[model samples]
Target: MTPDEVIAAWDQPGATASIHPTRGISEGAYWASGEAQAALLAQDIPAGSRVMDFGCGDGRVAIPLRALGYDVTGVDASPNMLAALNRHAPDLATFRSDGSDFGKHLGRRKFDAVYCLAVLIHHSHETGQQLVERLRAVVRKGGILVLDWPVADEPAETNAWIGVTTWSRDQQDQITKRLGLTRLDVDRPWAVYQA
Candidate 1:
């Protein structure tokens, strides 16, 4: 799906699963999963660091990360999602974008770390790569990026909005090299890399 299509699907009512699979189980489970993700991120992200929660759907992980002492700015493509986040966390800084135009929202600022979860898999490889490059541009040199990009034995790109896209090991490796991302040895579900 293109970024606009992904945004449309997520903005629709009853599309909670597109934002998070755990939402289909229970509200408690969904929020708990976000807490778990925040906890994992806290393990690596330094306290008081400026962080960007890319694809921050309704401040799920972003809220908990703020509680953990990180200065988090939420960014998302969907206006409804940002509005929902505003209702939930009115004080948290947020930017509306389809994984582009950071400077328009943030000016010349840069983040210490960025985490993108449940976002990239919905896009095509070329679009995902473009998004990644744009994300990398907003981070300072040596800043960390915790991404949900996955690799599978048999790589595939899902056509559905909520489908998972997996890359081959070689494909991942090549992108890592091209992006100048050094893979980190981290005990986390998402791929950790340093720019």
Candidate 2:
């Protein structure tokens, strides 16, 4: 599905629940390992650094990071999802934008670290590349970009609520190389890159 279609679907009633039936909220709200992510992030980023949660759905990562004392801003395409996040983290800054572009919503602001977790699978390879380029532009020099997506031996497509695409390790490597990003770590689907 197109990004617009995906956003429309997420805005529908119970859409968050549908994506995370057992958790009863979007995956971001109660995803396991929030502490682990926080710990990992703290190793490189100091407390109170500015962070951006790209494709932040329902404040799964942003809230925990905020509680850890980092200033966080979340950007998402679904108003319903952002509303859910607002209810949970009322003080957390948020903006409405499809994951493909951040400058359109967040102008000249740059982040110390930007994370796009479990959100890129829904985009096609072309769109994912575009998103990486846009995200790179918003990250400060020597900043971090953390991305998580399902890994496959070859590029593959799936039909869930919307069409989802997975990129292979080689594909991901090429993307990072093309963007002139240095790969810092790769724990399977989760890869950290430095700008």
Winning candidate number (lDDT): 1
Q: Compose the digit string of candidate 2's lDDT tens values, residues 84-123.
A: 8999889899998875556577678799888887677777
Each candidate's number of clashing pairs is 0, 1
**Taking the tens digit of each residue's C-alpha lDDT, what string does model 1 give over 1-195?**
777888888989967555677888898888898899999998888789999999998989999899889999999998889998899899999989986788888788889999999888889888888888888888888898888988889888878887988877688778878888888988788888898
Worst 10 residues of 1 by lDDT: 14-23
All candidates' lDDT scores?
0.87, 0.77
Q: Superposing all C-alpha atoms, what RMSD in Å does each candidate have to the true structure?
A: 1.3, 2.8
Cα lDDT of candidate 2 equals 0.77
lDDT of 1 at 19: 68
For residue 139, give model 2's deviation from the true position in Å: 0.5
Best by TM-score: 1
